[model samples]
Target: MKSDDVAKKLRRLQGQIAGIIKMYDEDRSCLEIIQQVAAARSALSSVGRDILTGEACKCASVKPGEDFDKILKSLLELT
Candidate 1:
C-alpha cells in the first residue's frame, strides 16, 4: 500500500482504539467492546501484511542469481 493509504489506516485504527476506550468507560457490554477490539486487531494485521507484501515485491525483482537472503529475511521478519 502507499504511504498515504497506510496513514489513513493508522488514523482509522486510532479512532477504533478511542472508541473502545469510550465504550469501556461507559461500561458497555463486554461482548460489544470485544468485537470492536477484534476489528481493530484485524485492521492492524491487514496493514502489516500489506506492508510486508509490498516490501517483498520490491526486493523480489532482484536479478537472477542475486543473493536471496534479503527476501528470506523479509519473509522471516513477517512471522
Candidate 2:
C-alpha cells in the first residue's frame, strides 16, 4: 500500500485507540474493551506488514549489487 493509505489506516487506528480509552473511562465491560484492544492490535499489525511489504518491494527493484543488508536488518528489527 502507498504512504497515503498507510496514513489513513494510522488515523483510523488513532481514533480506535481514543475510543478504547473512552470505553475504559466509561466503565465498559471487560469483553467489550478486550475486543476493541484486539482490533486495534490487528490493525497496527496490518499496517506494519504493509510497510514492510512496500519496503521489500522497493529493495527488490534495486540493482543486485546495492547494499540492502542494512535495510533488511532494519526491516527485521521491526518484526
Candidate 3:
C-alpha cells in the first residue's frame, strides 16, 4: 500500500508486459504467449486489489458508516 511497494509492483508488471512483447517479437509459441498474457493479467489484478483495499481502509477510517454501496458509488462518481 506504500508508495515504494506500489512502485515495485508496477515495475514488475511492466517487466512482465515487456517480456510478452519480446516473446511476440521472437515469434514465441501460442501457449507461451498466452501464459505471459495470463501472468500480466494476474499481476495487474493484484495491483488493483491492493489499491482498492488501501482506499477502502482509508475511506472507512474517515467515514464511520456501514453503507459500503453508497461510499463506493460516491467514490466511483468522483471522476
Candidate 4:
C-alpha cells in the first residue's frame, strides 16, 4: 500500500491509542486497559505486516532481490 493508505489506517490506530490514554486517566480497570493495550499492539503488528507484504511483493517482482536483506531484516524485526 501507498504511504497515504498506511497513514489512513493509522488514523484509526491513533484514536485507539488516544482512547487507551483516556482510559488510563479515568482510572479504568487494569484488565480493561490491558485488553486495549493488546488490541493496539495487534493493530500495530498488522500495519507492519502489511508494509512488509508490499515490500516483499516488490522485491519478488524485481528478481535478484538487491534489497532482499533489508526486507528480511524488517520481517525479522516484526516477528
Candidate that beats the other on lDDT, 1 or 4, i.e. the better one: 4
Per residue, candidate 3 scores C-alpha lDDT tens digits across 23-52 of 999999999999989989978877876777
Give the candidates in order of lDDT, highest first. Answer: 2, 4, 1, 3
For candidate 1, write residues 1-79 as lDDT tens digits: 6889888999999999999999999999999999999999989888887777667667776753446666656565764
**Sliding window of 10 residues with minimal summed lDDT for model 1:** 63-72
What is the TM-score (0 to 1) of candidate 4?
A: 0.72
- Candidate 4 residue-wise lDDT at 9: 76
Residue 49 C-alpha lDDT in model 4: 76
For all predicted structures, in order, the TM-scores are 0.75, 0.76, 0.75, 0.72
Which ranges of candidate 2 are over 4 A from the true structure?
Answer: 61-79
lDDT of 2 by residue, 1-79 (tens): 7999999999999999999999999999999999999999989988997888677867686753446756665675776
**Where does candidate 3 clash, by residue pair?**
none
lDDT of candidates 1 onward, in order? 0.82, 0.86, 0.80, 0.83
Mind giving the per-residue lDDT tens digits that candidate 4 earns over 9-49?
Answer: 79989999999999999999999999999999998888877
Between candidates 1 and 2, the TM-score winner: 2
Clashing pairs in 4: none
